[model samples]
Target: MAHSQTEEESDKMGQFDWFGSIGATPEAVRVLNDQPILFTILLIVLVAIILQCVLLWYIHYATLKPEQKVKKEKKKPAKK
Candidate 1:
């Protein structure tokens, strides 16, 4: 027995355009599809590098001591 699609299913299928509906051009989608593994690796590396830099900056900033101002005492003149 063969199953048939209903009107709603047909309409939903008709409205689907893989690239256009997702807002990406066909060429962009094609490129991503072709190099999915490479893109995934690059994205992971980029995020790791960014996180490392942020953590390093936070550590450095946390270890820093704010400078304190030194107040000098006024010298009084001795009376003869």
Candidate 2:
């Protein structure tokens, strides 16, 4: 069976550009494509760092110590 020129061109066009068009730079895309393992590890590390920061903030603010709670209550003026 023989394929038409347009069909062949269309097939070629359908191939994904490893370097995406507008958002990601070609160099960044190439690095990600080339080193998927490194990318995954880095992504995981970034997420863990973000989660750690959020967890620390939550621990500090969401669950106040008894002494800190007393200080906050003392700071607020009582309504007449």
Candidate 3:
């Protein structure tokens, strides 16, 4: 029996071939893709900023100024 090469295997190898690249290796690409630590850190940072903005907006526009309201009430009685 003789070994035969198939067109599909040849195409797959060609697709994955990065034979003449400079600076970056397959190991580096594999390591970068496999690790999720950097992604997780970025996600946490984004969530924190979003939460901070939400809290800031709540404090800016949602809270009532009880002291100012009381002062207006006092002045209104004196004016009448």
CA lDDT scores, all candidates in order: 0.66, 0.68, 0.58
Q: Candidate 3's residue-wise lDDT over 28-78, tens digit each?
A: 544444564755786899999999999998887657686544344345555
- Which lDDT value does model 3 have at 63? 75
lDDT of 1: 0.66
Off by over 4 Å in 1: 1-22, 66-80
- On TM-score, the leading prediction is 2
- Among all windows of 10 consecutive residues in model 2, the one with the lowest summed lDDT is 10-19
Encode model 1's per-residue lDDT on 1-80: one tens digit a residue.
65465544334532223655669775565566666776678789999999999999888877777653345889999899
Per-residue lDDT of 77 in model 3: 54
Q: Could you give candidate 2's per-residue lDDT for residues 23-57 as a string of tens digits?
A: 76655765666666866798899999999999999
Write the number of the candidate with greater lDDT, choosing between 1 and 2.
2
Error of 2 at 31 (Å): 1.8
Candidate 2's TM-score reads 0.46
**TM-scores of the candidates in the order shown:** 0.43, 0.46, 0.39
Which candidate model has the greater lDDT, 2 or 3? 2
Task: Please identify which of the two predictions, 2 or 3, would achieve the higher TM-score against the true structure.
Answer: 2
Candidate order by lDDT, decreasing, is: 2, 1, 3
